[model samples]
Target chain A: MRQRISAVVIGASWGGLDAYSRVLGKLPANLPVPVLVVQHQHPSGGDKLPWILDTRTAMHVVAPMEKEPIEAGCVYVAPPGYHMLVDVDHTVCYSLAAPVNYSRPSIDELFFSAGHVYGPGLLGVILTGANDDGAAGITYIKQRGGITMAQSPVTAEARTMPEAAIATGCIDQIHDLDDIGTVISELVFGLGA
Target chain B: MKMPESVTDEQVSIEDIEIRLLLEAIYQLYGYDFRCYSKASLRRRVLHRLGMSGMPSIMAMTERVLRDQQFFVTLLNDLTVNVTEMFRDPEFYRAFREEVIPVLKTFPFIKIWHAGCATGEEIYSMAIMLEEEGLYDRAMLYATDIDKNVLAAAKKGIYSYAAVKQYSENYRRAGGKTSLADYYTAKYDGVIMDQRLKRNIVFADHDLATDQVFGEMNVIVCRNVLIYFDRDLQQRVFRLFRDSLDMGGYLCLGTKESLRFSACEEHFEPVVADMRIFRKRQLMKRETR
Candidate 1:
């Protein structure tokens, strides 16, 4: 039986821009669920990721305002120097707390919050990166009965992130970078047989 | 594949309930309201305190928190977000100098409130900017925080020398006219901010959660502080800011925060939208017949 997915969370670090363009760029403009992305970046980094991703993806990408409502089809990217968490009330909240895994917008923080809130209605995706930030998050998502996916190690620009996530034995699918969008679309829209 | 019945589901719900009760206990015993704080972050902080205390659970921690004043104070420190740095978002400072300063020049005197001024890094940063702009003598800066401990630190105006290097870089990027080193004298392993900067500054305890407005100001900078609050509390604070600002006063929030959904959204217009600088709208003139 297929469970209804409410939100899709994608986490990446090193080489995330290219990976994001490949995966998120393919997601349809009329997606039924919100996509939250946490890409590790410098603390002083400006809010340019959303604008860059907005140019690539069909979905509307934005650096969400504090306590902004989670809207369908919109892609919310975590701002630098802050941890983005999903509140139980379906709003995005930013945290100035200590960085986890040396990352302010840690994937683990977002995943833990979203998994706890969305439970089985979340789809957690781990993409190309050089760290193990998203591994624990994927484990939590899986434990919460959410679907988890990872980019195949060979296809990833930096395989450590996906490899680490794959090592957790929690991921439901391992797809090539190019095929991730299609799989996500299928999982979200139930487009496949 | 069929999923197993999750035991953690029950555990999660139970933890959440315990947390709610714990917050309620804190509020009832002491007036520091953590009830309206964003729960995800609040829970993380509470659990962190619980872990450090080596308590069994939040319930057990709450028992100690209610009985012990010192323990509760430690918990309050954990609950309040105190992470701040000098010129943290340099672009915001740059924008303030460009857009807000020109208008501020028109006023004979300026009153600026630094709400939640943790450790006073940004307050001193502002003082330096004002000093460079030749507005320091005419400016009265109020630095306030809920935690007295950080406020005391803010008053001391001494920061580690290691952090000062990054602060210098941030100062430069923030369009500093002179070297950041000029503002502080080096002490033993630390730098003490210029005493003159503190002359016009007043450090005090002000809780946005329950405190009333004290003064109308030319600018109110409460950055990154509102993110911890829930919707209702945020709205209340927004109204407080709106009422606290004189007509045409500038309001600067954190880079990522917005006034879009607030009740006072229409009360101010964006001066630098990217930097989150806003100006309170002037009152409508009565028609002259």
Candidate 2:
């Protein structure tokens, strides 16, 4: 049997807002897998993302606080200016220790921490972006026996990030942006395919 | 640090081994302790420096670290990047002006401690606030950090002139009584903060992980510093902050940080929840925050 995914990490940049809306909007409510996302965003605009995504998805969407308990069926957005990482007891932790790869809530930081936390039950997806932030991170997820995937470069609003992830030679599948969320719901909750 | 119960020496990879050894070497040679820092973040910083140095391994980097004092200083910049801005998260400052300063004004004399006050952005910001509120003459601000280099920089109070625009905006939003421009004069390529603010400020080298209780204070603001430390170190600092604070003194943390899960939670109650400002409570049973 395919190991059920327990957590999902999504990363994107450049054209992420509309693309995030698409992926998050299409997901079912009972997405047993916890979803965490890191999108390169300006620190000043920290207020609106979770609110915007909440309208798109049935899942409980939030920009979690320091040491907040991470639970299933919720989407946590990494707040701008602070990085979101997982702790030993599975709490959501925030960090201010400078930016990685020029992004504060770096995709690599989230993916690496998720791999450490969920291990074999992790699924990391690299969506549209203009840079290669998540490529090596997905590679690391693959190393930890977690599933790795990339949004189809052709379907992505900007292909650089997804293409970079595919170039890692660790991606298990490449699916269209619209279908990726359905695939995840199918894998985790047996809802959509 | 990684939990000892879950990881063995063998489970930690060679890269991790190199990192541990490097940290050990740095400690043994320099007496600067970073061993208690968060493992993942420490790993990232070491790897970044390792790559920048173009060394094949962290072991090699450690070798260079021992041989060259200058290289170590360069590594220090990478490791302790004090990347902060003035009046960051303007809401917190607005909160300070409206909610905190009023309570502080009641005191005849005020002592403020800005622990882990990286590059002194917030200290200057605090000084300006006190000056506006007519409390500057009576307040003494102790600014401290682990890195002596950053402490020296904090003392200089100079910043890139370009940053003034954003700082001005934040100052206005933070309820500044006077223009933000009033606090600094333009230098060659930067702006030097008004030297008058430095009169009551003391910049010192202090480590949260390995330092003693420095003083009794009415407010202890250690924002964004606890996030770097592990659980044990965080608790240690909380205890330090708790003991050092006067009864009913304020404790301000980074907007994202909390004492809710910490050992020190029982000693503090939220002054304003949204602003992350807490007041020291009398020793009592753990009630709700």
Candidate 3:
């Protein structure tokens, strides 16, 4: 049987961060699912990931820990220069690999792995980015019977990414950044059902 | 600065002086401190702003920017580069575990700043560390970036499932305690990170290029985000980060980034030397930046 959504995965670049913050900030503390973020970033150097998100919203955001068991109601970010994936048993995993699309934390890497692990239980969101990193991943989500959404062109900083996903005609909703929270909430709690 | 002669019919007009005067007018009318930015980059960014605003000349744009705060804000958006992410460097996280965590155990309530945290991945990564180390409950992480759009993404904490897999092995090498899967449940095709990790974080739009100091912090990490700047811009940022550190506070830089050539290099000693982590010297009093 298809389980209700237990996790949400988001991919973005360019103008993505601001949009993500607003949506995550609106989510209440007791959200039913966990969230994972994979943003395209440089692979070497810098500070901790959790600290950045902690200040942006009330959500308890943290970077993925190698070998850490995935749990609901928390947020996991992919570390830089590594791919963020889910193990068969639902634990977070990271790896260093050659850049896909010249990006270490390729959105495709995260989406495909999660698609394999979560099957029909996943929900994917592609936000504003400069390139088409998440296009193939969105297709994977759709094929697996998972819900998919993209940022509307009106709100995207660089509409190329969301537009690319939309071109496949596989996306369920193309939402404005401001309205994304509603989509997530509805999916997470089966709200309005 | 030498005055440039705009001689027409033997009448000498100082065109260069007018440009300097324009900059001063911008400063006086608006609070933007572009006076110290590299002349070339500032010129380019200002020119771009001018084009976007459909001004016929820099003089006209300057006049408008001086009058409207919103215009200045738009100019500010173009001036700063707000590009970054969480645990931006996989090796840096690995090194932090190997080198820094052993020492961080001494602190009670750790205060950290992700300076130039364009999109806030660094903030999220640090919070995860504190949690794994049992320090999160008492920790406060501050993430700042100049770009409003990126800051919003850092706040959302949602990602696609396919792309996150790229970092799977990196997580395995970083000493992740459980399957990465346990932290989030998959949906549609993406993963929404858990909210609890963000509890102690505060993401704000801050500019190291022009903004004043925020507060003393135990660690300040500004990564690959700074390479886009010129030497002078780098120096200015280094000074700001230096001023914001508590005694012996840690400073982490991008892998390709270093403090060796920075004006404030002497202010800090290497912690994880190879990882570009530094410890601020205890004796260095906070300078009046």
Using DockQ as the measure, which candidate wins?
1
Off by over 4 Å in 2: A1-4, A26-30, A87-89, A116-120, A143-145, A189-193, B1-12, B285-289
Better of 1 and 2 by DockQ: 1
**Total backbone clashes of candidate 3, pairs 3 or more residues apart or in separate chains:** 133
Estimate, for each residue in A27-76, the C-alpha lDDT of model 1 and write its tens digit: 99999999999999997777799999999989988778887899999999
lDDT of 3 by residue, B198-239 (tens): 888898978676788889888888776554455677787887
Index of the highest-lDDT prediction: 1
Lowest lDDT block of 10, candidate 1 chain A: A184-193
Model 2 per-residue lDDT tens digits across residues B76-129:
776765878899888899998889899888999999999989899999999999
Q: Chain B of candidate 1 versus the native chain B: what TM-score?
A: 0.93
- Residues A84-170 of candidate 2 have per-residue lDDT tens digits of 887655777776767778888899988877776677788899999999998877887887777888899999889999999888788
- Sorted on DockQ, best first, the list reads 1, 2, 3
Using TM-score as the yardstick, the better of models 1 and 3 is 1
TM-score ranking from best to worst?
A: 1, 2, 3
Report the C-alpha lDDT of model 1 over B1-289, residue by residue, as the tens digit: 4443452677889999999998999889987788888888887778768868999989999899899999998888888989888998899999999999988888999999999999999999999999999999999999999899899999999999999999999999999998999999999999999988999999999889899996999999999999899888889998889889998888999977888977678788999998899999965565211
**Where does candidate 2 chain B have its weakest 10-residue lDDT segment?**
B1-10
| Candidates arranged by lDDT, highest first | 1, 2, 3
At residue B138, candidate 3 shows an lDDT of 77
What C-alpha lDDT, on a 0 to 100 scale, does residue A124 get in candidate 2? 93
lDDT, candidate 3, at A141: 78
